[model samples]
Target: MKNKLEIKIILSLCFVTIITAVTAVPLQSAHAFSWPCIDRSDGKAPIAVSDDNVYVAWWGNTTGNYEVMFKASNDGGKTFGDKISLSNSTNGTSVEADVAAFGNNVYITYADNKTGDADAYIRTSNDNGKTFGPEFKLTNNSDSSLTSSSLPQGMKSYDNVKTSPYELKVAAEGDNVYVIATGGDKNDTTYQPDVFIRVSNDSGKTFGKDINLSESKGIVSERTEIGVLGDKVFVTWWDKGSDGTDTPLLRISDDRGQTFGDIIDLSANATDSNTTNTTSS
Candidate 1:
C-alpha cells in the first residue's frame, strides 16, 4: 500500500510539471502594452484606423521635453512599431496630438508654443505612418509674442471646471484632409478662443488659410472634432453662451471646407454640452 501511494504522488507531480512547461511558452504575437514616459506627466492620445492599419498619437516628456509622439501598427492593434516623435524639433512644448488616416496617408495635428503663444501645427505621413514630413503651421495666433516658458501651462480647461484638454482634430479621406482647432483671435480683445478649420487638397501636402468656424463671442472650451464624408465636412465643439452655460455647436462644409455654413447649436438647453460626430460614405 505504501509503494502504491508513492507512485500516485510521483505521477501527479509529473503532470503538474508538464502543464507548467506548456504554459510557459511565449506568444508568437505581441500584445498591447504601455508606452513608457517620464513620471508626473500626461497628455492626450488619439487613435485612427484605416483598414488593418492603426495609428496613435500622444504627447509626453520622454525626451525631458514635451513632444508629440506617434506609433503605428500595420497589422491592426495586435502589435505596434517603435514610437516616432512628430514634434521632433525645438518647436517649444507640443501637446494634444490628434491623428487621422486614409489609405497610405496619415495626419497628425497638435498645438505647440513655439512662438510664445500656442499655435496649431500638422505633420503628414505619406507612407502609412512609417515616416513623416515637416510640420506646417496652421494658425498664427501667437501675436502676443510671450516667452515660451510663460505660455499656457499644460492643458487649459473651460471656466476652470472641465479638465479634459482641448484636442486639435484631423480628418482625412482620399486626397483631402481637414483639421479643426480652438484658438484665440488676435484681433478679438475679449480673448475668447474660436474654432478654426484648415483644408488640405493635396493629401496634406498643402493646406489653405485658417477659416474660423465658430465665431462665438463666448469662450470656446473642450475639444473640437471633425469628420469628412464625401464632399461634406462636419465639425463640432462646446462654447459658453450668454446665459453662462456651455452649449454644443456644429458647422458643416459642403465644398470640402472651402466655406462653412452658419453655426448650428446642437444643444442650447443643456449645460456643459459636448458633442462628437461619426459618418460613413
Candidate 2:
C-alpha cells in the first residue's frame, strides 16, 4: 500500500513539472516587414556605406532597357529614398555597375553601348545620391571593340556573338578614380582585345587616355579587377598565352598607375591539380 501511494505521488510531481515547463515558455514576437526598395528586375545591387548613409548601385530594367540605378538611405539602411538613374540613357543597355563613396561624393561606374560601340562610363554625385553630375565616357576602342583570347590548351576557341559587350570594374580614393574594362575579340586569337584602363585624378570630372595593361602581342586578357591601397595600385586579370594554358596574373603599380610592375602568374602551378596552394582549400 505504501509503494502504491509513493508511485501516485511521483506521477503527480511529473505532471506538475511538465505543466510548469509549458507555461514558462515565452511567446515569439511578431514578424516585421519592409517595403521593397526597388521593384522590376532590380538585382546585382552593390552597396557602399559612408557614416550613417548607405548607398546602393544596381542595374535595373525600369527603363525600357537595362540601366544603372542609385539610391541612398540616410537612416542607416532602415529606409531608402527615391531611386535615381545614374546612366539615365535610353540607348543600349548599361550593365555591371560598381559604386564607391568618399566624403560627400558618391561615384558609380558602368559600361554601356551609348555610341556604336560599348564604352566605360562614370557619373558622380556630390550630395550623396540625391543628385548626379554629367556622364563621362572613359574608353575609346574605335579599332577593336572587343578583347578575345584563344581557347586554353585543351579547349577550342569559338566565336561569341556580342554587341558592344564591355565589362567594367572600378575603384576610387578621394578624387582619384581607376577603371578597368575589357572588350572582347571574336576574330583572330593572335590579335585579341586588350585590357585597358582609364584614370581620373580630379574625381570623375575628366579622364586620361586608355592605358593598355596587357601585352600588345600576347593572347587576349579579360576578367580584370582593380584595387588601390596607399601609394600602390593593383590590377589582375585572366589571360591565355600561346602555350595554350589560361593563367591568372597580377600587376602592381607603386606610383599610382603611371606604370606597372611585371605580370606575375597567379596560376603558375594550376596544372598541378593535386597542389593545395589556395587558402580556401
Candidate 3:
C-alpha cells in the first residue's frame, strides 16, 4: 500500500510540471497591445482605416519633447510599424495631433509651440503614413495676434467663464484637407479666444487663409471640429454667448470649404454645458 501511494504522488508531480510548462510559454501579444510610446503622452488617438491598413497619430514625449508621432499597420491593425515623428522639425514641441487618411494620402495637423506660440501646423503622408512631407503653418498668426470670434447676439447669458485652449482638429477627403481650432488668450473676456479654420486643396501641402466663424459680441469662442463629405465641409463648436450662456453652433461649406453658410444652432436653450463637434469624414 505504501509503494502504491508513492507512485500516485510522483504521477501528480509530473502532471503539475507539464501544466506549468504549457502555461509559461510566451504567446503572441493581442492586437490592441501594440504601439508602445516611451515617454509621457497625450493621445487624442485619431485613427483612420483604409480596408486593410490602419493609421494612428498622437502627441507623445518619446524623445524628451512632445512631438507628433504616427504608426501604421498594414495587416488590419494586427501589428504596427515603428514610430514616425511628423513635426517636420525637432526645434520645438508639438501637441494636439489630429490625423485623417484618404486613399494613399494621410494628413496630420497639430498645434506647434516651438516658438512660444501655438500655431496650427500640418503635414502630409502620401504613402499611407509611412512618411510625411513638409510642414505648413495654417494660422500663420502668433498666439496674441488671434482675436476672439463672435457668436450671433440674442437672449444670451454671460457667465464670465474663460474660453478653451488652442487645439487642432483636421479632416481630409481626396486631396482636400480642412482644419479647425482655437487660439490666443483666454483670460480676457473681450477678444476671447476664438475658433478658426483653414482649408487645403493640395493634400495639406498648402493652406488658405484662416477664417473666424463666430459672431457673438463680448463672447468667448473655442473648440472646433471639421468634417468633409463629398463637396460639403461641416464645422461645429461651443461658444460663450454674449452673456456667458453656452451655445452650440454648426456651419457647412458646399464648395469644398471655399465658402461656409448656415451657422445652425444645434442647441435651442443655451447654458454653460459646452458641446463640441470633434470629428470629420
Candidate 4:
C-alpha cells in the first residue's frame, strides 16, 4: 500500500511541473500594449482627455481662412475618427478652441470672429461626435476691434482688443456644466481681465449668470483650467501682477462652483515667479 501511494504522489508532481513549464513560455513572451495617435492633417492645439476619450481641437488655415477642426478617440488613445470642421462660415476665423466630453455628449468652446468680434461660441455633439448642434454665441461683443476681418491686417491688436473671450475652459460634474473664460470691459481701462464662470444644467443648451472668481481689481488672471472632485470644483490659473510677473494660483469650491474659497498659492516657493504650469489632482 505504501509503494502504491508513493507512485501516485510522483505522478501528481510530474503533472504540476508540466503545467508550469507550458505556461511560463507564453508569460515571458508577453509584450506591453501600445495605443495609436490621432492623425491631424494640420496639427494645431494640444489634446485634452476626459474619462473615456481624447479630443484634439485646432485652428488651421483652410483656403486662406482659418477654421476649427476636431478629432476624437474613444479607445483611450488608440485611434481617432476623421477630422470635422465646426464652423460653416467661409471667411470666419476660429481660434483658441477647447473641448471636453462628459457622459454621452461632447462640448466644444471656442472664440469665433464671424460676427466681426471675437465672440465666444459653444457647440455640442451627442452621438459620439458624429454630428453637432447649431453654433451658439456665448458673448455679444459687436466691436470691430475684437473681430478678424482679413488675413494679416484684419487681425485684432492685442493691446487694444476688448470684448473678446480668451483661454476657454470647461468642466462637468453630474448634470451641471461649468465654463470659465477671461472677459474684459472695453470702456473701463481700470477693469482688468476677469474670470467668468457660466453654468449649464441642461447640457450645453443654455448657460446661467456669470460669476466672477477673481478680486484683484486691475490684475489679469488667465490660462485657467477646471477640475472636479466629488462635489467640489477647483480652478487653477496664472495671476499676472503689476510687476509683469505671473504667479500660479488655485481656488477651490466645495459647493459646485457656486462659491470659491480663498486663493491658494500653488508654487512651492511663494517668491518664485519662474514656474508657469499648475494642475490639481
* Residue ranges of candidate 2 with Cα displaced over 4 Å: 1-43, 141-165, 184-189, 216-218, 242-244, 269-281
Q: What TM-score does model 3 achieve against the real structure? A: 0.68
User: Least accurate stretch of 10 residues (summed lDDT) in model 4?
Assistant: 14-23
TM-score list, all predictions: 0.69, 0.67, 0.68, 0.68
lDDT of 2 by residue, 1-281 (tens): 22232332221111100000011222111000111111223347877787888999888776488888888998899999998888876866677688888777888877665564445567788897788888765544343323334344433222122223234666777777777666432233443545666666776666655455665344656667788886677888877767877777777878666677676777666574332222110
Tens digit of lDDT per residue, candidate 3, span 1-281? 22232332221111100000001222110000001111123347888887687999888766677778889998898999998888844666666678888888887776664653334566777887777877765532222211224312431222111111245677888788777665432223344445566677877655665555654335656557777798888888877776668877887878887777756778754664343343321
Candidate 2 lands at a TM-score of: 0.67
Query: How far in Å is the alpha carbon of 156 misplaced in model 2?
Result: 26
How do the residues 15-57 of candidate 4 rate in per-residue lDDT, one tens digit apiece?
Answer: 1000001111210000001111112233348566666777778
lDDT of each: 0.59, 0.57, 0.56, 0.58
Q: Determine the backbone clash count of candidate 3.
A: 12
Scored by lDDT, the top model is 1
Clashes of each: 0, 9, 12, 0
Q: Model 4: what TM-score?
A: 0.68
lDDT by residue (tens digit), candidate 1, 1-281: 22232332221111100000001222110010011111214466789999999999888776666888899999989999998988874656676678999998998877665554334567888888998988776543312322334333541321111111134678998899887655544344344556666677778766666566666554544357778898899888878766778877788878888777766678754685443342211
Ranked by lDDT from best down, the candidates are 1, 4, 2, 3
Please list all clashing residue pairs in model 2, or write none if there are none. Answer: 146-183, 146-184, 146-185, 147-183, 147-184, 147-185, 147-193, 148-185, 153-244
Give lDDT for model 2. 0.57
